[model samples]
Target: MNIITLYHGSGGKGTHELIDNIFYKYFYNKILDQQGDSSIINNINGRIAITTDSYVIEPIFFPGGDIGKLSVCGTVNDLAVVGAIPLYLTAGFIIEEGFDVNDLEKIAISMANAAKKAGVKIIAGDTKVVEKGKGDKIYINTAGIGSLRNDVNLGIANIEVGDKIIVSGTLGDHGTAILCKRQDLNFETEIESDCNALNGLIEEILNSKLKIRFMRDITRGGLATVLNEITNHREQGILLDQNCIPVREEVSGVCEILGVDPLYIANEGRVLVVVASEHSEKVLDIIRNNPLGKEAAVIGEVVKDKYGRVLLQTNIRGTRILDMAEAEIIPRIC
Candidate 1:
């Protein structure tokens, strides 16, 4: 039987055969080929950045991407937002017993394609199979390594009152798309997940020589949570112009129907960038020119306030306070 079984994960002949035939065959690289207890990688001269993430998005397959592609992009974006050039990635897969070998091959191919698109390599990986009922169809974990630019110094310490906040594009697309597909909620327009690698777009911004204070990918708690975190300890507060924020019509509709705030919804491809006010326009222009950032906009700015907070200037010329999500709105959303 070609299906994965307990024997395949038993650390014996079956395990070796599986590694030699499938894993090594697809993710072959000089460093990974060595197959030592740990992978040996060359040290970078400058600062090195490392990040890890796990993907357990329900359904495994979704409208725009699958768990495999998401795993690679998730890690790559994490490294990239910190002003790093992603170099290599290590993947760990957990598959359920009796899973289809053909589906596994498809996922492997998807991971390879995503890594190629992001200009990174999958240098190492591990595979394990669990009992059929003990696991979902599959789960993936990835770790990424990148080299940081010596000239770039980005962090909360750099954030100042007057810095502008820019979001890469529309919000909540990924979360809405996943929710719809998972619940079998049909809409006239099919919403696809905005699952993409943002390293290229971020690279463009970095090349423009803008003074970016900090950058974060809106993932779990969405933009609101990210903004709150950034302003938590600082004396400065964030003032967001609600009208300036970009939200897709379909995504907005889904959120309204489900009573979810787009600001609190997750996004896989969107980025929250804070730059000095003087360089905001140039930064916005650079982001707009990129395919992934065509809808980029300056949504808000940092302000001097007694208490660290996030305030939203409503469209009707009123203001309201926005805070971090008190509870989980959506779960298992990668």
Candidate 2:
């Protein structure tokens, strides 16, 4: 009974006990505690943004965060990038039979803490148990709903040739952290995953007078993939300065040893922002003042190109095409 069993997933006493003891205990709220099939929320007005994402990260537990935290942050950041104020979340868990109860509790606690930090409530959730061999130790899916700011208008269509491209901080921290942990590679220095909810940092930028043309969280395919997505449907391309882009020395060392490009590596807490050229400095200052954006830098600018390509100007006197990754360099890294 200490560990999850098949019976816990059945709609019976075991299931009820698991819900009341774990899910409800950590995600207790006026709406969630009601234990209704669907939560009824009121006082919602204006535009609403909803985002859902699933987390199947291997090792579940990493140096800086676990799957639980990742699940909440993944969805919250998605909403934030769209100029939304996250309000509620629903978490779904698929746990393997024989998974440790303590580990499950730890994950639940992490989710609760992350939700609280992002100022969002977990209003509903579901848990299911699968055969040990058929499933990883645990997988998490989270859906978030938020209200959009009326003054905010952000999208790829708003991107122009003179717009500035800004990155919140250093790249490849999360990917490198997971890679090292998964491979059990011990280097001279340690790297921790930058898995965090970016709502607070994003809110500051949204509230300011800076013109935010477009924004996205640097996730699965890293900064390169995100920029490619922005330029995919447009006639403009992105030109990045290699020297201005922030990459930690430790992360650079790891990527160099592994022959991986940090541009294509994953990041959980970083954001890519495109803003008006006139407001670029103000936006950069705002982001740099925030703790999450201390390393924020203007790495690139949009350009009119026949093909919507991404080019990286190296610190040396060479330029290289930073194309979308043909295949996943590191899979299940988010």
How does residue 292 of candidate 2 score in lDDT?
93
Scored by lDDT, the top model is 2
Misplaced by over 4 Å in model 1 are none
lDDT of 2 by residue, 144-262 (tens): 99999898999899899989999999999999999889989898878999999999999999999588999999998899999999888679999999999999999999888888889
The C-alpha lDDT values of all candidates are 0.90, 0.92
Give me the runs in candidate 2 sitting further than 4 Å from their true place: none
Angstrom error of the Cα, residue 112, model 1: value is 0.6
